[model samples]
Target: MALEIHNITFDCADSRGLATFWAGLLGWNVYYDDDPEVVVAPSYPNPGMGLLFIPVPEGKTAKNRVHLDVAPDEGTRDEAVERAVAAGATVTGDHRKDDGTGWVTLLDPEGNEFCIERGAAERGPRTSTAYRIG
Candidate 1:
């Protein structure tokens, strides 16, 4: 038997707001929107590996131990970063190299960390972890 990831859950202060931020960032749609819990995915009928946001009384106090690394499907990394910033994300670090390699780290509206890396069309052969560190 094999197991697959069904959802990546986030404990946040505002479930709907956080889910909306993620849905816009990932070009997904909010499938479920109920108080204290909201879900965002690529689709509704068959939402594969959705992002689930649940309300918590407390706010984030520290850096996230696990974070998401995303890439654009049809744009550059900088463009993606710009979109994220417009969607209520704050840039925490910019790690792009002189040769145009690396990722940008940002915090979501609720302070959850995520990264924007080179898009599929822009990435070449990844030889080492030189671009992984930020």
Candidate 2:
């Protein structure tokens, strides 16, 4: 018997401004706001999986069947998509590639969508080779 994944809600109209834009883009902290809901996390007994932001009336029409693909543990990936467009986010899609691999589709700030790969020191080291199923 095992089942986890405490939070990951987000159905927002402004639950403390999308939990302060995802607690300043994952620096996570907002333990909990008010007015409906808003509870980011990365500490305080956080065993991983947290980010609530409720309060939904009706918005974000269509798109986003399930998203959130960030990858910058530090930098790169166009500087984390220019720090997520200077923390307001909105570059609907860019799918960077030309030998740099791809990923860069942001939206946040109430638009939803997410994605901005290329971390792990900007995807260096890992000659590649993986296909196992036994």
Candidate 3:
């Protein structure tokens, strides 16, 4: 038997609010907005993985050990970063190089870190050393 990923859960202060932020950024819809938990994902048929926001009493205190890296389906990374900022995300780090490589790190409304990478159009073609981590 093989196991599949259900959802990526997030512990937050306001589940609905955080879910809204993510939904807007990803162009996904909010499926569940009930108390205790809020879920956001691609409409219908389910996209295999969704974001689950659960309310918690405690607040985020440090950098997240695990973070999501997203790439735009259309437009440039700068455009995606702008959209994220307009939707309540804060830019934490700018790692874009002069040669049009790298990504931008951002913090969601609840301070959870996520990154925005070059879009498909911007990336063009994948190379052997495209994602080499130093």
Candidate with top TM-score is 3
Clashes of each: 0, 0, 0
Clashing pairs in 2: none
| Per-model TM-score on C-alpha atoms | 0.90, 0.36, 0.91
Q: Which structure is stronger by TM-score: 1 or 3?
A: 3
Q: Per-residue error at 123 for model 3, in Å?
A: 0.8
Give the TM-score comparing model 3 with the true structure, all chains together.
Answer: 0.91
Q: Candidate 2 at 117: error in angstroms?
A: 3.2
Q: For residues 50-127, could you state the per-residue lDDT of candidate 2 as single tens digits? A: 878788689878898998897878878898789879989999779787999999898888888989889889788889
Off by over 4 Å in 1: 33-35, 125-134
The C-alpha RMSD of each candidate to the native structure, in angstroms, is 4.4, 13.6, 3.5
What does the lDDT read for residue 19 in candidate 3?
A: 94
Predict model 3's lDDT versus the native. 0.92
> Which segments of model 3 are wrong by more than 4 Å?
45-47, 129-134
* Better-scoring candidate (TM-score), 1 or 2: 1
